[model samples]
Target: MVGRVLHIFNIFFFLISVFLGSQVQGRSLSVKKPDPDNAAATARWLVAQNSWGVLNTISSDLGGAPFGNVVSFSDGKPGKGKGIPYFYLTTLDPSARYGLKDPRASLTVSEYPLGTCGKIDPENPTCAKLTLTGKFKLVDPKSKEAEFAKTALFSKHSEMKDWPKSHNFQIFKLEIENIFLIDWFGGPKPITSDEYLHPKM
Candidate 1:
């Protein structure tokens, strides 16, 4: 009977841990969410808080269909985000190959990953979502910006530093042309690329 009770206690503790861990936020949000009314801030915060997102590209393999792949990215170190997501991709992947063929892509991120959504469904408007549509251009590996991007990516994803060099990975950034953000009720928020790069807040 004592052994059975001990086993039950261990199972109970494991279940408690699982429940708590599920509430943990994605990456290092370190900062609280901005006001829902602050479109730029909310969008930037969503980008900075999450480490992985769906990167959409025009896929040749799909006979010119929009292909979305879940990819890891970093805008900057933790809270010091620049709102320009940098991805370390290799030509071995279809997204990278398509980007090389045609430099058009978009990345989408959601607030649900940050655990701030509470119990609400991910599709709810109040949950917040950001989509950045832009040209996907490759960064010159020897440029200063590449160094900054490497630091940003490695800071968030340490394993990237040790990724197989044979993979021929390269850095790429999105040149924001349009922003679609929905944080609350009503239509999508109107935020220009300039406002996103240089928010008053």
Candidate 2:
């Protein structure tokens, strides 16, 4: 009888934790998979819903080799995403370091995290993926855009507020020049930067 009671208590505790964590993160996407046929909407949904992705840069230390690092970003406050990902990074990290030098980078995100794919392989075309290629420019700390970025980033990732001050973490954004979205088997969808930024979602 005691074992069963403990098991029940454990499950209750887990449920509470999950609820609290989502509230803290403010990133519950509802796994709301939009119609895949709409390329712009699909791409925007992928960027807005997912918070972390692989940020690729040209590595200076590795003789200009292509480098990718897992990083966290946010397009805007919850439910009001602007389709432009903002990142908080310190030069100590290779992605930030290399990206600052070359300014050319790409951020890749997969829809697998939305948990709507079920058992399908992540690489499957039906699962959806997006790549944003452009220059990674640092936001001027004294500018108004920096204030907006701070709000956008912290709303989705609350923990960033408590990071060590000594790290010199700076706000950066992708000046998207090209967008590649593959949500179905036909082929890569051609999406222009303007269309992606101003999608009719």
Candidate 3:
């Protein structure tokens, strides 16, 4: 009888734990996501929340072929985003070198990493993804924009501040000319650079 009682207790405890875990997951998914109808707001939210993305550029060394690299970036400090993604890159890396030879580039970010996608597949239309295509220009180290870039980057990624200075890291910004956003099943939303930069949200 004692053995049977212990077995029942074990099963009861397991069920309780599973129930609690599901509740926690549900709460995380409940985090507010911008309405899909608000194209500009949704695009801005994706850029503002994501810290890293795939940055694609024209490769100078590879006969001008398309090259993509994983990069960390920041739009602004926390909730105050300007909708322009800023990156800290070193010419020691191919992406920065490629950007110098050809400024055309794009940055792609997905909502999956944010943990708000719930059980949806990442490729699902409702999961949302954004790509900002534009010129990748280096920010003059002596310029005011460079200062803001440093603060913005260091604020989100503190380890960047302590990275080796010998690497000669520099700030780069994507001068967005076009924006492609997919947040729903219909298709990509139409968002202009002006609308994305000046979102109502």
Clashes of each: 0, 0, 0
- The digit string of per-residue lDDT tens for model 2 on 1-201 reads 999999999999998887886666544756477798878988999988888999999999999999999999999987788899999999999999998899999999998876667898999999999999999999999999899899999998889999999999999999999999999998999889988988876
Clashes of 3: 0
Name the 10 consecutive residues with the lowest summed lDDT in model 2: 22-31
lDDT of 3 by residue, 47-94 (tens): 877888999999888888999999999988877778889999999999
Candidate 1 lDDT score at position 201: 66
- Measured against the true structure, the TM-scores of the candidates, in listed sequence, are 0.88, 0.87, 0.84
Comparing 2 and 3 on TM-score, the stronger one:
2
Candidate 3 lDDT at 94 equals 98
Q: After superposing candidate 3, which stretches have Cα over 4 Å from the reference?
A: 1-31
lDDT (CA) per prediction: 0.90, 0.90, 0.88
Error of 2 at 3 (Å): 25
Predict model 2's lDDT versus the native: 0.90
